[model samples]
Target: MRVSVVIAAYNAQGYIAEAIESVLGQTVPPDEVIVIDDGSTDGTRSVLERFAGRIVALTQGNSGQAVAVNQGLALARGELIGFCDADDLWTARKQELQLARLERDGELDAVFGKVQQFVSPDVPEQQRARLTPAVEIMPGELKQCMLIRRDALMRIGAFDETLPATFFIAWLGRAKQGGLKTAHVDDIVVRRRLHPGNGGRLHTEAQNLQTLMALRKAIKAQRPPE
Candidate 1:
């Protein structure tokens, strides 16, 4: 199956290249790669330009990740769709293994793997161990660790733009409600970077609260009819 990877970037010059390289180096590289430059003010655009011929790059005014993701998703022509954050890296076999599972179980609409938290090399060795930790990513909240069918994603529709922290979780919850079969792989497939500019830190407590509200609504909506 043809696989497409979407990357939404914003002021990610320092790490976007690494993110793209990781995708390009995947064991079973994606058939299509879409990068949405979400109004990056730094050198991110220039960095993306370096990969002109290799990827389909799009630029738009500052829109949050939800819109950026939708923009890229709309252009994806592959049978399977995946995601990678501009500041995160993926294991070489991520797409290969996840796609294999999805294909093996024809009923499964999506599959996700584990994630490893890692700090940049600039961090001291002593703190690196504590800072960088490996953990399993639960279903209904995984973005980086997921490989989904394009049709399933279209049925779920675009993400809620209002949410900051829980957009992805809410979307995943709906995917379940939509009757999309899902599974998990007991393997690490994403390297989630812990940096200063992470969305968790950028958004405020009030915004985070909105995420909680969104999740509740999504779960409530998924309930069977009384």
Candidate 2:
């Protein structure tokens, strides 16, 4: 498998179909698409079952997204790892373009593209350009928009299972400290849903603070004062 797409799903029945369809529609279909069901009480299981054989479904106790992601990472057999939130949708060409870019630049450890946010599902075609502006990315930008090398993930330690909500922040800081080569792609590859029901956005203030603090600790551990 060249690429593994991991998604942590919890009560995502409302949006799981779109997420799955987005992956299925990718220009470069992933070698394996794994959906970790973190004990969703909703109809998420049934929805996932509909895609059996099409996707690898792993279910476990309610361990939260971080743990689920780690499990998926461990199970992934791809050289590259792509992450997608169960609520987000990817552009059809996202994986294909990113894989080609990565192959062309073999030195890079990872790459992140642009992301757009929408409150309502009916975003206008022309107005969609209001999303994130094209900008050069530093490793500190954000992990959600990036595709990480599987080996890099193991070296940095997949999502920190200890801190459920702030794992990505810590992981990104560690990657930067370890001198991973990274780049940014200007094209919009995914759409971030902004509904209040979404856990990440709804708890952004708290999670952001926690993530920042965790990142600081990780950075200090990686680079002690000279």
RMSD of 1: 2.8
Regions of candidate 2 where Cα sits further than 4 Å from its true position = 122-144, 223-226
Please give, for residues 70-162, the per-residue lDDT of candidate 1 as tens digits.
Answer: 889889999999999999999999988898899899999889888877677666677666555455243323687889998888888888877
- Model 1's number of clashes is 0
TM-score of 1: 0.89
TM-score of each: 0.89, 0.87
lDDT of each: 0.85, 0.80
lDDT of 1 at 218: 86
Clashing pairs in 2: none
After best superposition, candidate 1 residue 218: deviation in angstroms?
Answer: 1.7
RMSD value for candidate 2: 4.4
Q: Write the per-residue lDDT of candidate 2 for residues 135-202, one digit (tens) a residue.
A: 42232244556777888778877777777788887877777887888887778888777554666555
